[model samples]
Target: MDTTRRQALTLALASAAFPAASASAAPRPTGVEGQRRADLGDGRFLNPVLAGDRPDPNVLKDGRDYYATFSSFQYYPGVPIWHSRDLVNWTPVTAALKTNIGNVWALDIAKHNGRYFIYIPVLVDGDRPLRTYVIHADSMKGPWSEPIDMRIDNMIDPGHAVGEDGKRYLFFNGGNRVRISDDGLSATGKIEHVYGGWPIPQDWIIEGFALEGPKVLRKDGWFYLFSGQGGTAGPPTSHMVVVARSRSIDGPWENCPHNPIVRTARRDEPWWSRGHATAIEGPDGKWWLVYHGYENGFRTLGRQMLLEPIEWTADGWPRALGGDLSRPMPKPRGGSGGAHGLALSGFSPDMFGTKLAFQAPRGNDYLDRVKLAGGVLTLKGQGSGPADASPLVFVAGDRSYEVTVEAEIEGDTAAGLVLFYNEKLFCGLGLGPERLHAYRIGQEERWPPGAPIDARRLHLKLVNDENVVTFFHSRDGRQWTKERSFEVAGYNHNVADGFLSLRPGIYAAGSGSARFANLTYRARGPSA
Candidate 1:
């Protein structure tokens, strides 16, 4: 064998054996992994049932299939729809709304009569006017129709309910209701103040009188309305789930004797600021409630989807079964089939339409920024860094995982993978002309001993364990070099306040575009 080839092989083996030699070493835990609450399938499940940054869950059950969507907000490919057979496990089915409608908030997903409809509430620029838009699809996996502006201004969180008169209506925030047209396409009548929300005690430390997230259900001649109050953030005890019910769809609603059905009464609890719930009957005919909450100190994970079994009292009021939601309760029974979540580690050329999505762009300009071929993704550079580039990202549920992608900068531009949280707060490492740039908090710092890259192809990897992130790069895909590491526990809602989580993403920014290839992702446990 040639001496040069033998030396290269020896170096590769040495780097693999020594952690210091390989720059792409996995990150150590930062103590946040213990808070997750999903069935890890290891005879144990984690808390927060749905982890990461999922918030404002709206769930719909179609026959045995259950579909759920949450507030996508600034994230494009708005209205991501998830499917599940058992309420416990969920997987992304499709991103329902592709067109940029506006900054989307809490939405309602329901199947009325025969069609599936999502009532979206968005804030348009001019007056900061809140409008609800309607989109329908024949099937959950949809060729969803374009959004029809309902023109119902100054309202949010549209909950669909069928009245006793066999007519459709929408219950919105601020205790308001509007009658819907027969076809459920548009509004027919004026919005009216319906029921005043329940009041909380004055001495109880809370956020504010934020009457929001009204969800309705018709059960046994009674129409039940579930609403959240006391603002979404502030004190840990703020943001609670409250209920009121009435026999008729219209008036004289009675508040639940136990008005606040679920709340974080104390800060010591594992989850904080719990509210915004949707209730449903489980497959076993048992009652269940799905809601959102910030996990203890890990507010950076955003408000995650939480599942708890509900039991009805003889008097017909509902109660939560999962205590404080910090511990595992009994899993719901009788759910037999369906997958949980899409594994993002592996990708083919066709992965974009399924497992991968770009962060929602303001305009449609970023749509043409990416091209996939032969299992590789080539992304054109945009913005100057992660913030403006609208980095291509995927939601990762694990608390600890590593993602690596092969990248080749075509011009004087730069490209790298990142854990991005909006434009202002993000951190990652990028390669530019003869130097490596380490970014944090919207600012870039240069790293010494950077690799010289005249060639177009380079491999990059990021390992985010808990909130800590580390970056690495490779030239020949064998030997590696660590670029920089950062602790990002504060890149979350409490500090940044976008109601978003720090997400795993890739960015190509600077002068020219970059071609990315062979993206590989892996979830690591304590051992890894």
Candidate 2:
């Protein structure tokens, strides 16, 4: 089909799939309601171009399609690259980095001269030192090259750009930039101060001035630099998006007249600490901004991906158009193709290749902790609970959902599924040799007078709706009984220091191994 005809068909399909008026419906219990674009069955659509816990987003438009990825700190099988044609609905194409590359942070994904590369800045575990690495792929899809240490120490965010002199460069935290070789693999020059980020007025309610996450975009003969400042966490008013631009890549850059393009000025806002952004043009040639923010009262959900439209003023600076981004906006135009989200249903061996991963394992051989064979996931015991076990997990966006798994305990091991946050804060259910363990506030409690069960084969299910979690068990697949229920709204950042979410996961801890099968997960949407 021709380009114009294809664009029209895409628009028609999106309109039918998402209607703008429908997109503005009453907010759902999950708080993500009325955020998705109305598929008007035409190719064009509405807002939140991407969804879920996809924070610190960095997108690269390659040819006719766009590829994006985000911070996958602690989560191995990290940096899953998503592809989108329309920018509204995205599908995971491949997970670029499989090996544990430290605690991954805000990264830059870019393409130059027909080659794709991802510059990752990570926080090393033992030393707590910061380092940046580069990984290359001939095509967006694997096989990708192993990570090459960039040797640019103590950096967190790596923003790639091409200099006016044709030199490759990367701008990192603290407004520093280092030159890279033409191969785009290693650093060649010393890190130098290039741009001084905007300053926040003192006495203003804010987090600290932690100036970081710089993204550079070359547009209309100008080099635009976007950065996040005022700390990422703490006061709801902290963290904000700022912009600067210069005629030269090596600049005397000027800050935006309206320095903060986006920020959370009050606690009443639906989202807080909103910053760390990357700007890109929509398929229709319109501008849009992608960033991350902590959902109000859902800090345990971590920083979620957010989208806002951008309007370029006559003076050349761009401003976020969606206000607080708590409401819906018109969708991007043009382009067709790509799926909206990931589905986790079927179980099979080798499935861990991408869909699931452990959060910051002690070593690379952590995969040895679990055996995936014969459609069952057998995990060895580790630590005492979900906190230490490095439970295998996946990204989930719904406020309420149910997860079920069949497990057969062997040896002296205990195994079950859990909603895990960190070592000090988390809650869920677990099954052991003598009794079913109910976990709340990082401690396990036994209930129902505690009945001992020797059966090796058992099914477990957890139903979590709006932060309240209930557990269930069954000896046979047909008959079911409630095990226990626990309220877990407190399993969040206020109690835990890590800016992590309470994730649904499966874990094994004790001495032996537990075999798991028929794992199923389903989300209860707004109506539920």
| Candidate lDDT values, in order | 0.75, 0.73
For candidate 1, give the lDDT of residue 244.
94
TM-score to true structure, per model: 0.88, 0.87
RMSD of each: 7.4, 8.4
Q: Could you give candidate 2's per-residue lDDT for residues 319-361 as a string of tens digits?
A: 8887876555556777775545544434442345345668667
Highest lDDT: give the candidate number: 1
Model 1 Cα lDDT, one tens digit per residue, 287-379: 888999887766766888888888998999998877787655666677754455544322343344345557657485556787755435667
Instruction: Name the TM-score of candidate 1.
Output: 0.88
